[model samples]
Target: MTDTLIKLAVQAQFRTRPTLRSVVAQMLTEHLQEKYPPLTLPVAQLRLALPREGGGRGLSPLVEVALDYLASGIFPDLTARDGLDAYLSDASGTRLSFEQNGTRHYDLAVVEALIRELPVIVQVGFQDALMAYWNMPSDAGGSRWQWFAGILQDQLRAAAIRQLAGDVPALQRINQLTDYPARETRSQRHGPESSLHAYSVQTRLVQGETQVTVQSSDLLLVDGKQVWLCNLSGRIEAYASLDAFGQALGSAHGRPVYRRQPHLATL
Candidate 1:
């Protein structure tokens, strides 16, 4: 079947689906596994050696506040405790009692309202979030991060949609992508320091199913499109494609794919 190709924005972080509801569903599904009704604030659990005297304290400065936000049905996909603004209880207890601030006075009614709305809000939010991914480049042929693009497929797509179908009408959209995966540039660097690992994805869409696949190779991107494949692990086997990348990952014992950042041991 003929495939459609589209160029994506350079800075696009995600590909969005056609509808706003889909975006909301994706966001909620992404957060559902998070610790809800959090008993403690994020990063609240800190360990400190007891002073020679007698001092052991838990609960960070933001603990109660964070808890309040959780109670508010805020987004759970957040990475930090400081992000607990809406869900955690505000300090003024305006969320609890006499409303000095816009926060509802702390009352079971307020808490109950949040609890009642949590699932619905999250579902809609996540559906919208998934739609955002489509806004990114779905054209496998042009995708430099083709491997990751391939994983953004229908099984996962349907799974994401199914999550919302339980509560909201399923979002329906037509998505199509086409791409090519050839080393844009061949490796020229010879020394040990000249090495990198990269991946590619190639896809074709058929009527009933989306055929997505991924590949990997060692390389570094240059000048936007040039690729320099490398031999990092001291072997020619380093030049692996998608199928080989999977095989190497499954068979290897120590590490499959290791991308380390500054101060990160193994990210």
Candidate 2:
């Protein structure tokens, strides 16, 4: 089921610009079907920012990033409080975490647990699939699993608020916009330096109607704190962050106002 779902996704990557993976979503969906239940929706989402060879930030495969982060913390003995998407330590370690599934967000764990009861089988299968997806050697799969476990530990060990905050605060801030009902992806660019995604937005109108949209090129930046938006005139209309842009879009337009929705048909 998982492999079938993933196969469907290969084409989706091209169609969607960012490739989508449905393995986890499918596994759970199928498991639910077998259990006489079903997931609420078709669960494939996640635009893999497949990394380039020369080495750039956004280019690395997300799994590799998550795996590398976890591997950095792997130790001899420790237990993890499993996060369905990732994991963390029950013993002493640094504070960090990452998800093998490429989506940028998760329901807060406490709320998630109340919603899904940890579903340990999902964890077991997820670990197995993640290993296979990465082509991990069978003999060292245990240690590889431990690497993921170590990632959980590192995150669990983070400073109080930071632990719960996220893996990368800058990127995390940008992701919050996706949760808002109105936000939409406008465009995407893939190249050696970094991957760029543009969004179309209907900003707030405390006084007048203004939107958050931008122009782009082969290269762009999204540190999560700020996204640079350029207009047809080649002037950059900057967004302080995805959230700031979202609030401005959802609220009302103001300072350095904008209202005309840019033509995105070409994108």
Candidate 3:
């Protein structure tokens, strides 16, 4: 949607003269739901990570920041913890507070720290998403909000995969396997590099379910002649090459065949 549409909606809401915080938030949330249906689950998960109050899930800090930027035309200063603290404090009247020992209190320190410590790439991704929504190109097709939503999804998915690397045994093993001596040395000397790649594999298991079923997309890390695959079940398999990986999948019985497609790893 265009800025004119958003500004008009905000103006219309002003006719009701509702609470500023509630009106702005409700408007933004409704717009988000209409323009970006795919973001609902991820945004909900992010909201859960924030401190909640009054038995309601916390609103996403990104959404709060977006609202501030839209209203003020000045992006939040995410460069420092203190800047983030000030921005969040000044942006909205709805404080994400909690009751401590029967006393109501609020603190932005934790949220500020979280924002400050966000990975550089993730920070960039969020900035891009916001910019896409605010300064959409005239020739762009479909809703600019949907494009913004896709970028947010990619960022969240990448963050989840990074977290999984530490938590999932199979992913951890894949990481280790991909980190050979040469690669480790290179990374140590030039800083760590991004190696994660995504691929979609469609396989049919004729023996069990006689229907063609699509398998969950997998993460792949290709290093030289070796390729590592991490499936949805946290199973890690090593193949000498991409061809070998495909051959292994094709080796299954019952006249079963599989199709593979490369996916853009938009991290």
Maximum-lDDT candidate = 3
Number of the candidate with higher TM-score, 1 or 2: 1
User: What's the C-alpha lDDT at position 74 in model 1?
Assistant: 50
Candidate 3, which segments miss by more than 4 Å at Cα? Answer: 1-215, 257-267
Q: Give lDDT tens digits, candidate 3, residues 90-167.
A: 123243333456734333454433334333233444555455444543223445444443433344344446555565
Candidate 1's displacement at residue 109, Å, is 3.9
Alpha carbon lDDT of each predicted model: 0.31, 0.35, 0.45
Per-residue lDDT over 213-245 for candidate 2, one digit per residue giving the tens place of the 0 to 100 score: 454331122443656443322233456776555
How big is the positional error of residue 77 in model 3, measured in Å on the Cα after superposition?
56
> Of models 2 and 3, which has the larger lDDT?
3
The better-scoring model by TM-score among 1 and 3 is: 3
Per-residue alpha-carbon lDDT of candidate 1 for residues 80-193, written as tens digits (9 for 90 to 100)? 233222223333221212334553422333333443454556555555445444444544454334535454333333443434344331122101111222223222322233
Residue 209 accuracy (lDDT) in model 1? 46
Enumerate clash totals for all models, in the order shown: 49, 22, 0
Which 10-residue window in model 1 sums to the lowest lDDT? Answer: 169-178
